[model samples]
Target: MEQTSLNLVAIAVFVMTLSALLSPALNISPFIPAGTTLGILTLATLDSVSWGGRGLTIFLDLFATPQQRQRVIHHEAGHFLAAYCLGIPITSYTLSAWEAFKQGQPGLGGVQFDLTLLSDTKTIQKTPLIIERTLTVLMAGIAAEMMIYDNVEGGEEDKKNLRAIMRIMGISNSLYQQKESWALLQAKNLIIRNQTAYDALIEMMEKRASVEACQSLIQEKINQIEVMT
Candidate 1:
């Protein structure tokens, strides 16, 4: 997200420079038209590039410090770790908004876990345990952000996903909120219990580990944690 934002800014600067240099030769003011066009395109691109883009994602990407990046890492790590602990198969993960954008994901970044094991088809009657696990995993990112920042907005997509799944499961709005709260509590407890493993996985993810390697490492960590406990 940050890189794309910078690229757009660079493009804007280039356009400005070109307009200034060409204005004298063309005997026309191209700055206004060019700026306006680029501004529209930039905003459109930003909208597509991230779920939290409008003001939140863009602000974090461009101006957030190193500590802020760490917060994001922790947030994503929560999802990754929770899914792993609950026996979900992680296909891949990302912490780059641009990468998620290229993949047509709505969120800034996320852990991609396979849900096929839960149900053969989307319309199938999902088991209670599967729904419970899914909800907990869905709320993991929010729980992590709240744990660290004491507040969060980055989990909008997560909440949306949770609600969508609940709707499909025929859960009502009142029940959905209750489930969300319970899921968050479950996620927080799991994340805290598996902090060391989560941190190790986060380190590997930061180094851009492949999906297979991540799966292997996650399983290894889970096994180690189980054995110790």
Candidate 2:
């Protein structure tokens, strides 16, 4: 499924790039703003390639050092750990561009979850637990990064995650700054408690596990948690 999506994205990019290259030669007015066109195409390509894998992998060879990759592993592990603890189902995870290209979604790497609970119309009246758990899960990635690296990079994605959580909690963006620190702290605690799961996740990432592998790993972890509790 992911491979097919990536092929489509690659074809789109090729067509757009070809059109851009040929426009001047054909004596035609540029049909689109070149900068905007390239920017959109770049984002689309990135999203398409990185959906189920680590977004950083695409640029890892060009920009990231070994330490940075380790940091990303921990960062993503934090997210996977927290979501698992919160009873969210993880569909897949990856740490390679080819995997992302195969899954073909967007942004950098991501841990896909079952959002069916959020979609339950009967649960329309939201609860505090839901809101808090959601925010903690969203902040878990950055918290994990900070825990290992003592700093953070690529936080824009985290902020977007936070914003979405806040929106779901019925809080406005204006209130995010006031609430973010506490949410991050909570996420850190969740990550700490689930350290074992985090470790397993990092190991899987180091192996460049594919979506199916990730799914199986997460399911096994979830079962372990279920048995323990």
Index of the highest-TM-score prediction? 1
User: Considering only N, C-alpha and C atoms within 3 Å, which residue pairs clash in candidate 2?
Assistant: 2-102, 2-103, 3-102, 47-105, 47-106, 47-107, 49-100, 53-109, 55-108, 55-109
| Model 2 segments more than 4 A misplaced | 1-63, 119-124, 209-229
Scored by lDDT, model 2 comes in at 0.68
TM-score per prediction, in order, is 0.71, 0.62
> Model 2 over residues 24-124: C-alpha lDDT tens digits?
89885666645555675575566556543234335432455777667767877787777777866677764444455467745455666676666653463
Q: Which stretch of 10 consecutive residues in model 1 shows the poorest summed lDDT? A: 51-60
lDDT of 1: 0.76
Q: State candidate 2's TM-score.
A: 0.62
- Please state every model's RMSD to the true fold in angstroms: 6.6, 9.1
Candidate 1 residue 59 Cα shift, in angstroms, is 11
**Model 1, span 30-86: residue lDDT tens:** 867577658855774665465445343444356657787687788888898888778
Error of 1 at 141 (Å): 0.8
